[model samples]
Target chain A: MSKEYVLKEVEFWDGAMASSQALRQAEVDIMAAYPITPSTPIIQNYADYLSNGYVDGEYIRTESEHAAMSACVAASAAGARVTTATSSQGFALMIEVLYQASGMRLPVVLNVANRALAAPLNVNGDHSDLYLGRDAGWINLCTFNQQEVYDMTLMSFKIGEHKNVRLPVMVHQDGFICSHTAQNVAPLQDDVARKFVGDFEAVDSLLDFARPVTYGAQTEEDWHFEHKAKQHKAIMDSINVIEDTFEEFEKLTGRKYNAVESYMMEDAEIAIVALGTTIESSIEAARQLREEGIKVGIVAPRVFRPFPYDKIADALKNVKAIGILDRSSPGGALGMLFNEVTAAIYTNDTKPVINNYIYGLGGRDTTIADLKQIAKEIQANADAGKLTTPVQQFSGLRGPKLSFFDMESSK
Target chain B: MLEIRWHSRAGQGAVTGAKGLGDIVSDTGKQVQAFAFYGSAKRGAAMSAYNRIDDKPILNHEKFMIPDYVLVLDPALAFIGNITANEKEDTKYIITTHLSKKELLEKLPNLDEKRVYTLDCMKISQETIGRAIPNTPMLGALMKVSGMFEIDYFKNAIIKVLSKFPQKIVDANLKAIQRAYEEVV
Candidate 1:
């Protein structure tokens, strides 16, 4: 831990509203938004700040989320720092432009209040939206609470606009859990935050009349593959840029953040890997289980996009068995997070038996009691010296038992 | 650590009450988290807010499954919403009801006789503020029961947070809080 870097009195703020404050401090030149549940407060607060002279910018209320993202792409290409907020179906509506923002190499910041995608038409927190943008070629950051929401929103502008990593970034927080929950937030002075993010530098902007640049050009079969390959390289190589930004932020703010956060992992025999607010409860569960003589630990990947494979594998190297918790609905296949984690640790020397457990989709509550029960079950598997049940299961889902990948059937 | 669950209607100020109490607790340099359940954001619908106060940072963001204190801003919600689900046996119920402690205990089967406390917060709020919100009075009753803050501390906090409002509104809320503090039994 570094020395506390607070320069003013701490204020209580919820995650959504604080996100707006961070965006205001960044002094974004343009924001195009369409309001959506749990995420509307972000843009709403920013609009209020702009109108109250707290920020100098343009807030455009668009007709639809698609138009909102489209305007962001246009403003960003025209050499303006741009930002927006969306959730659930709103994110789904912007899917096409999400690719455009990344493909055109525009560094637009998006605050995604993670919410459940609608088929049953429910509005609540889930990873469906976060997962939807995973393959859209944007840098993804996960925050557990209000502090991270403020800190990471500032850090995102730095990482996404870095010359080496000019890709849009999505800072995700669980819907109601973080977005609506109020907590203490120590905000940096406006000038300090502005200096930390630094001045916006446009690489190849449409505003440069002398040096004409063409955007949205169709890269047919001849160059599409090569263009996409470079974009892939840029995102894959952003890990270094992200770490450097984290280091600089820590130096300035005295708050230390890691790519993969470990909780009681040292000498842990049973470890659970999760994301978002679920990690919060899992940590509490880990502490209680430790007192009960159960060697339980938790691993959470703070940076979800470039999916910190090596860091997470190292964190769980000593654990005997791993429980990978995925919050998104898995219709016919294994959970998205489970697939990525298993691939990350596939080549580890210890080769711990990792299982997939889907929980908390559609805002179903995942409590400490549920986590404790999972820890006990995974502990039982480790003691048996072999696989005890199916490798994949839906945890905490009400109704009859549902399990995938039966070990016996696979054999 | 203290965990509380507040029950009220959507138009009521349970969410605001949770934040107001959090403001006072955090003023004492303790960590606090305040949040409400999102159920369509419709008016007059049953809604709930939660608070967690501790000397250390709070980690659990899930809704309260077992709260130490349950403050009911609307007495009818106690039975209508099953507000006492998954509560501790010793959980204290500070309710805004015209019913006496004996009468409230008789009505709310889930509440223990010794732990239940009643206050006519709605009546006080209507008399002072001319609104039936009852959230400010409930906060006062909570402050009295939990001893979480001095009465003066909350009074100053109320003034600070509502400094932008009209004097009558502020004065009425302050009066409601004082009356609830004196009348909770």
Candidate 2:
């Protein structure tokens, strides 16, 4: 029996609550999850909804994240709409199974409250876990705030479960910052949201005995390369479906989303390329800089997995200099975002002076002041029409200024 | 933008108070953000929660702030929590303590006497709500000090926010809010 839940036009919700509510409205068949910091509330709230009769879904309390993802994979393969949430170390544990889920073409949804990986065992927001899973064959979607967390969670199911894209999707939100912070979120009515998400369409379901289909068949070297190539093509081709889904959602909700979100980029001279919650903060900084007559803007990849290289290049085409901010530690080289953005721009005619900024690791606060300083540095580069600072620098890191790759010295 | 900070112990309801305020503020079509820093701290450990209210969508996600108002929910935290950190020149402090404003300012000589407001939220919650949870009473005091909303309007909004609780508990919280609203100085 479903309980009477009066839907509000809008409500105050944290990122966790927003995502959990979306999961509930999607009416997922199974949620197998192991609790982790920051992400615990998402599954916890879903479990509460399940017990209270608001959602007719099964909540499996697995012992570990590995077991949780394993359960999700099993359920998804068995033709159940499956989803779960995890962060940090738990995400690392689930990495082994993430590839399996995608390789088997199971459209499972994983909500990752992005956190820093362990060394001193920190439980704070960063992109270390997000960066770690970039190559796991899951379509990654990044969110800027609580509202996007809800919006993207709903869209993830539609995009991943599309017939053309039968692959898993990961929605990333910065842990603590977005997950724990309460803010205003306008959610779709239950009936409308349900209609938008639609029902789970099972293809080659394991439960269908009459059609009995085999999954996870070992291809070995004979057909493995071809299989992998097909998987890559599916991921690349899913971009169209993702765009259409975004458009449909916009039509229903009037909130538009783009493959690459550009803010104040019209005729801008310098730009900050970033992701997650930092994008909003950088936009605020850029707005303040604009008051001082500085032509600074922000560009962020809302869809990170298929990597919208063309959109990113077009967004930054008019800028004279760019700063790519990555919130994860780059063990020995330039940041992942820096590498990707530069690769995208390398094919373009307008070659801007690009610099990498590694920042906000292990939950360090990325303040408006720090972002303003970054924009000023980019402006300096734009004025000089060449690289003025090191090719890469650390933002908000303590102690003496740490930087690398002095192009001048190399030259 | 209106920024506020709360200093309290982990068990105390600073996070809840901040979120409750956010809920009430958001109802008026204003953008609000409420969050806390939880560094794996246990109950009885010191913690802080924060709120930001603005007319436009808040684009800043940084925890750093020069708070316009500082709320100290635990009496002991008044002395040790560095409640004045990053406070603006016109920042108002609403503290929960049995001590009078003069006495609190005397003990913490650095505080501006004109800006300090004190009330016994712990006692009010104990007497009215039948518990020592001072967070609701602190909200009442903040309502009186900040005057961001009228007493009756704020209480009704909070009543809606606490609709999940039993009628008896909700009534008690309303009384606690009313008492602190009148008694805080």
Best candidate (score: DockQ): 2
Q: In candidate 1, how many Å is residue A42 off? A: 0.8
Best by TM-score: 2
Q: TM-score of model 1 relative to the true fold?
A: 0.97
Model 1 misplaced stretches (Cα beyond 4 Å): A1-8, A409-411, B109-114
Q: In CAPRI terms, where does candidate 1 land?
A: medium
> How far in Å is the alpha carbon of A355 misplaced in model 2?
0.6
| Candidate fnat values, all | 0.62, 0.82
Candidate 1 residue-wise lDDT, B48-81, digit = tens: 8999988888898778558899999997886788
Per-residue alpha-carbon lDDT of candidate 1 for residues A1-411, written as tens digits (9 for 90 to 100) = 112223335777889977988998888889999999989999999888788777778999899999999999999999999999999999999999999999999999999999999898878898999988899999999998899999999999999999999999999999988998998888898878989999899889898999999999998999999999999999989999999999999999898889998988888999999899899889998888999999998999999988899998789888888889999988888888888888888778886767789899888888898899888888977887556778888888889988988877433
Candidate 2 chain A weakest ten by summed lDDT: A1-10
In candidate 2, list every pair of residues with a backbone clash: none
